[model samples]
Target: MTDFEYLEPEDTRAWVLHPELLNTPAPARRNAGNALEEAVALAAALPGLDVIGSEVVRVRDPRPGKLFGTGKSEELARSFKENEIELVLIDGPLTPVQQRNLEKDWKVKILDRTALILEIFSDRARTKEGVLQVEMAALSYQRTRLVRAWTHLERQRGGLGFVGGPGETQIEADRRAIDEAIVRIRRQLDKVVRTRELHRASRKKVPFPIVALVGYTNAGKSTLFNRVTGAKVMAKDMLFATLDPTMRSIELPDGPKIILSDTVGFISALPTELVAAFRATLEEVLSADLILHVRDISHPESADQAQDVRDILESLGVNEATPQIEVWNKIDQVDPEHRAQVISSAERAETVHAISAVTGEGIDALLATVTGMLSDPVHEDQFTLGFDQGRKRAWLFDEGLVVREDQTEAGFDLTVRWTDRQRRSFERL
Candidate 1:
């Protein structure tokens, strides 16, 4: 057995272990408490799982075989016995051997953080692209746990089937099932990607400056989307309320048209599988002329959540050169004093705006900021189109790119001022 290097906790080590040498570090559990709450929230969001109770188990010197110390494991087991808990949700990563060991000792089903997230994403994904991505991510994750293959759960196309009796049977893990499934999903996803590329190319002809709204989950992204676009999208105070991407054409205060894309909200420790799978989904952000990073200013972990969004953005290949605006949302929840302070601070920041999407406060300023940002270092050009080029002429007008036009006998002479992206789109057309 390889000796595991359980990080010796700083505080509470002397006390927790004097009681028992191998007791989980209390400080570690306290640090994990917030993550455990988030895990519980994630469980609550999912269907089919009845969460009885959840807590953080701090393992001081995490053992290779059992993870927790003998005493601590017995203590948790007693609690499980008393509560008749059916499933144990771990807030952190777990090795397969430790997972098997914990299940045997506790006599209940178990799901670690990554598995739980993957399962939730599996349940929530709607479109064909989303489904394929989930399957690919799940298979990739499951590949790691092939060491202990139990496949009693009936495979469902929609959900990652983690359902069954105490001791289940292993089917796919043995026959390179995941490998084959991954290959198939990749082939399908490739087609979807190509189709998306074509759609994007088509969108280029229309040439609407894309302004994508990104934020932490439950950060009022959907609510803001509805407020800005007057388009009713599902807005709820739930984790991952909006899964699929949605876009609508919205006009700025002064009438320049830009496309507003409401993207899937981000979260801390987003599953690697989901990230890779959904990168295609977030491809909207890549081409976005401006990225509006909406944030929940009221949440205690708002700063941390903001950092997580930044991390994911970088991971998804958002370049530093791309224009990004920080939108501090939910100021309506704050007191008047705090709200004033927030607005003042945002005003001073170069590319930050504070707004309450629900109350419509500060939204005007935010929109004006967006318009100004879009209009920076504008490009003006002229083109002569024949009578047959009415569609192209109409496209230019529709995009609000035409500054002046003179009808000539041959056709129309048009003067257009537009961004480089708009220019490129016009060229494609």
Candidate 2:
């Protein structure tokens, strides 16, 4: 949680490398080029870093002390020096020893995928809970990397200290300090979580179904959310743009009112520390009455991205019985040839819809589908209740289930349209 700021005109020159392990199982490996591109994009998301170059380094055998072999490491060092690279971002997990050794050999700061992501979350987090979660995740990540100066831990700006500031005196951070910080953060987080739970309980009593939007990073969940709810959420084309859960109530056209939630986007190989830290933030997804699995249908690895979201959702323990609709978003970005095919495929699926959240294409049908799914069956019925049952009449009126009420000589005659669940509740009353 360092608060150090980068001086002007001294942006950190960075290089991104994705180590493509030859020994990795074919099914377990991602497209190295795509992975490198994603890493570059991730780097771009952070400020004060100029990503000058990136590549997929094919590694037959990874060195223990240094992730890359001696010759390869030396060659990369020379290239980094030639390019005036001040930071090296490895698009994979790196042990503390490996990271320290790489920084020593290359004469640059080294940040693995997990650290980079933690930094981004630290930067993007706006809410108190989000900031605390990122801090806890960073502490957990840094606890293992105590081999280097934990300057990032001392900054007030909440950065992980991977970018600049080279000549500061190295302060050896102890395990006890980080452990104490973790404990303190947990206490604060528990309070925040309790407050959030109180708010959630209040929301539950509002008689609106909660519909949550979930997707991979930059998959346009926020855009879709803003389009539907008309709320000015920060819908940026960046990784983890929406870090905290944002909810708004909106009445669908000719449909029931629902609480719509936009949640943090999922990514491939999400850091374990982050998953644990942000579980509370993801509780909104778990309690959702319905989930919209948004996808960037125009991306080349859209299917892979969707699977990653699903894997994260499953890990978060979302109920399998909960309904889900596949939202194939960003159709406007897809090519004409594939756009037709994508729309056709979605048309055949009962739970899939293809639309451009920006262009308003196919949104009406999607809303109609959501309405049909959330709308419960209703039937008209008449009932007579005496004045002694004033509480029951009041309850019926409060539920908006009463259509007409007529005063009778004995008491009242009521005509109501309600679902089976409402009728059962009335009978219980």
Candidate 3:
């Protein structure tokens, strides 16, 4: 079965299709190539899957009736018959009419890019809000594709012989029901947003800085998040493994407390419908005090993926305003020479850190640097506590990173620069 609880044919074969357009900036090289790679990766990631073959087609003039030319369609039909391919996975969004027409030609199940992403999200989402947001996005995406996608939905109606309780075709009924569900989900999502806003406001009152982790899918953001916060979040090699935003308190070497949030990873060619639906979730990134742009240094397309992430951030209008820290992750996977080049290049950026999340290398430096970046300029105060006074010493340890220590005759005299929260917590102690 697919991730969305959709039953899959055991003896099914899938042929991946891509439409090429030379006029646009995203031609076959950029769009089709990247999308096809991801589609094949997704197919491999699925629990149970069978792939007969994959092909890329370039249609000079995309027909309104069918996405492919007549000749190509006939070729594909013949190929499917010969190979017994039972499904077609299109890398681009398909209009309802185009989808219906294309399916008729192939006589098999067809899935579009949006549906595939939704199915992945349905499987990855863990929290209640996460599930609701995914469902909301899927519903919104489905609303438009209903005509071509959901022809299987049917409702039985028999009231007073002929004209009865609901005098409408099953399609119309399903559309109305889905519309109502969308409305309800939006209201629920509004509530979720308000609740999140309240939590954010509360954190603002506490004065702990909020740092959000964001990057392209499988960029090691979740792994870095786990490393920094000591939270056991699910960090896998697959795409879109972490959906919901998770926040945790982490202590810096200097004893400053910060709230670190791991957010949904961005992807190239993310559906516009989903972006609109998940606006509330993206708000967390916008409200962050610091944004960590994590990059999987080992990926072949890491730089392009970083650019894609920046483009999405720009579209969200949070790119310019948010203070950013560039985290080059997965140094463990990089070769020595390449890793040296990356590290040397990264040193030019003002707020860049290189680390390996798997090995915990350079993490302490990352945390210490973050604490230093967040240091308040208003004050410089230090206090000494005796080691014999365990409570006082422990209080000092929690409040600040020790800068200088003296093992005096009286006790352990320590000098520390405290974070804002550490100062407050220290006073209470």
Candidate 4:
């Protein structure tokens, strides 16, 4: 089998490893440990793989050729041999040369954070766009790391060997191939983006105001969206469960229609490459008329996670001034008294919607608030439309809150509440 397609033996064990500098400050080391643990847990959840163990090693001196010093590298080699580890998973992005050197020295397959996460996403992606994005990210990541199994060669005379060595390096060939793949992927993604733009344009004319659900990974945004819209989007307790955005129509209490979109959850330090690759998916959040920022209020890092979501949104050039409803979700999991205290301390009375998505708690109030935002009056006009103009009536039912509709002998006499733009359209009709 080709190297890319070859699977590790079933009996092989995978080790999630992280390296820290020995002289690093205690607080920094502690954070590294936490990050390593998080990465390990995520790695362990990948299907068709067995995680034998995980560890953090302190390298006394950083070696340019390898991440660890000579002695530390020797020690790691011994540990790998003792554990019979078939794969070494690093907790950070590694350059192609570094990956090749590490695999050769450790005598095991090496995968850095980007590659491992890409592998898991490849397994979990369900939609066509999702699959394409994952493949594109993976190809972009692997293009640099395509080196031969080993790079050890005897020193040779100065003439042909010196000239041949630099030109024929496996790393260079891999990088060139990766560039080609990236070009192809970008062209394909352009098509996908154009198709998505068409859909978005159609949605704009549909007259339903869009409400996009967004938050940190595993923050219950999907759960809330599914509850409100009755969509069967995947709502697992894992990072990036819903990579592709999904939208469904929901009827409000006042009979007006609104579109609720469930988008890929945000995360702290999300890989830039993945973000660029999933631009088509994220455009949903960018164009949303309103954003619901869901939060797992019970999590210790909830505040930091919320900040991260804001940062990502800002980076995407999405207007922070756009309407946002801060939905403190998963409140049922917290102590009732604590939840009450949190709600009391929160200052944003109008913009905050505290509720537990898993339960039918406070959801009605939140939906009512969203519907009010959609149907709120920006303009008022009187229009007379013929009964045959069903499109105008339907637009009123969908985007505007109809106050009165009466059948007249000449035509249908209707009183519609809508924006000035809609009022103009009605006048033309």
**lDDT per prediction?**
0.78, 0.87, 0.75, 0.74
The collision pairs in model 4 are none
The top-ranked prediction according to lDDT is 2
- What are the models' TM-scores? 0.78, 0.83, 0.77, 0.76
lDDT: worst 10-residue window of model 2: 164-173
Q: What ranges in model 4 sit over 4 Å off?
A: 1-12, 18-34, 57-62, 146-173, 335-337, 346-349, 380-429
Query: Which residue segments of model 1 deviate by more than 4 Å?
Result: 1-31, 148-175, 377-429
lDDT string for model 2 (1-429, tens) is 779977679789999999999999988899998999899999999998999999999999988889789999999999999999999999999987787677778878888999999989989999999999999999998777665544433443233444444323333324666788899999999999999889976874676877889999999999999999999999988888889889999999998899999999989999999989999999888777778999999998999999998988998887566789999999999999888999999999999999999998988998998888778799999989999999999878878888999998989999999875456446645
Per-residue lDDT of 366 in model 4:
91
Q: Lowest-scoring 10 consecutive residues by lDDT in candidate 3? A: 153-162
lDDT (tens digit, per residue) of candidate 1 on 280-399: 999999888889999999877788889999999999988776788999999989888788898899999989999889999889989998998787677899889999988899889888
Give the Å error, residue 118, model 1. Answer: 1.4
- The digit string of per-residue lDDT tens for model 3 on 82-165 reads 988877788777887787777777887777878778777887777778788888888777667555334332221111122223
Weakest 10 consecutive residues, lDDT, candidate 4?
A: 153-162
Question: What stretches of model 2 exceed 4 Å from their correct place?
Answer: 1-7, 147-173, 378-429
Evaluate model 3: give its TM-score: 0.77
lDDT of 4 at 100: 64
How many residue pairs of model 2 clash at the backbone?
5
lDDT for residue 410 in candidate 2, whole number 0-100: 88
Q: Which is the better candidate, 2 or 4, if ranked by TM-score?
A: 2
Candidate 1 residue 207 C-alpha distance from true site, Å = 0.6
